[model samples]
Target: MDTPSSSARVCGERPFYDLHAEAYDLIINDPVKPWCDAVDAQLARSSSILDAGCGTGRHAAEMIARGHVVDLADAAPRLLAQAAARCPSARTQLIDICLLPTADHDAVMCRGVLNDMVSDGERAAAIASLARSLRAGGKLFLDVREAEASRERADGEPRTRSGFTSRTTWDNGLLRVRETYAMGGDVVEYQFTMRPWSVGSLTGLLRDNGLRNVSVGGGVGRRTPDRLFVVAF
Candidate 1:
């Protein structure tokens, strides 16, 4: 389900919300830590922010801790629940970004969601949907995998996860997705889904959606290009 291409309501790749929301953070570390830190440093104060693909509410919690009014929205119901648990005051929504409602936030944030959808068309649509949620001059933040970077992690500690397990096996071009779970109102069965996306392609898509001042920032690990940003209308 690449962006600007596939339909979440139709593709059936498992709604993220229904996935292991309760255990996402336990499985994944701060995938885009640098970006979060940047967001903390450079964002409108007391603004309304939307954590678009807020997985397990990690970033949302960070934003709330910083005093930003946050709306934790995601396609996964279970994930939203977890986010709510982390920040009970945050307004949570179970929304598939590709099919989001009308609203313009002061700022928006999304990470690790669009890349899962493997089609460019679907990815584009999803971003466009996110753009619509932003008001004029509302900044948007998102991160996708850098197509050119290799996923070769140095030999070190053993990595593990819940619900699904993934490993970087391609010389530097594939993300290995494996595992399945049927709970939280959905079923997730996936493995060996490779994604090839580049920074240039992402910038083009953002411009197509009328976003200005798009930029790419540091990713989760200091070693990787984890995210791209779109300062929206």
Candidate 2:
């Protein structure tokens, strides 16, 4: 039987992260080696990196260990706190990607964040903000869900990990997800929406934001099936 406290309610991305912060690392612990390898291959030695939308600072911590200067930024305070705790040496900012500083880093790695921008205007603004965060000739690395593949897999059975159970459904162009965490006598639930990206549409957005030399490839690590790893300069 389900917990009596279980309730369904819509939530935005920030609130979802804030609620999920404590369980995030355990639930979403995919290996970071592949992504770090990609970054190493593309960036200069000892490059300064901005881990935009960084959740728990896993990537930033790894990048710092590999001799790169990494700063973390995210809109969710709870998530950012966890990130800072994980990477105490790295600088952190509590700000959205759309308001990131201009020309500040040698490269920016934004993983699993773009899909949350459900509107074209929000997507455009985000890309533009990321572009502005780059120094001249700097690169941008993005990991996002591929629309077709994600939609095809959206209706899969519920997945439980780290005391959380998650189910997803694709409707129209949105991927709606519900996550429930039940531990001891307490239960928490969150629902959120995401809009995946197609190659052509994403490419056009990058170009419009003055980000050229776009390359889209298969996902890194465990995300290979339904995600796209994109690189732009």
TM-score of each: 0.76, 0.91
In candidate 2, which residue pairs clash? none
| Residue-wise C-alpha lDDT for candidate 2, range 70-161, written one tens digit per residue | 98988777888888999998999987677677866899999987888777777887889889998888899999999999999898469887
TM-score of 2: 0.91
Say which candidate scores most in lDDT.
2
lDDT (CA) per prediction: 0.65, 0.81
Which ranges in model 2 have alpha carbons more than 4 Å from their true place?
1-16
Q: 1-233, model 1: which lDDT tens digit per residue?
A: 33323324422344333434455565566545556677766676777898987777877877787789999877666666778888898988877778677797888887767766666666777888888888888887776666655344422223444444344445335555455554556656655454655777777887888886776655644444444443434
True-structure lDDT of candidate 2: 0.81
- Residue-level error in angstroms, candidate 2, position 50: 0.6
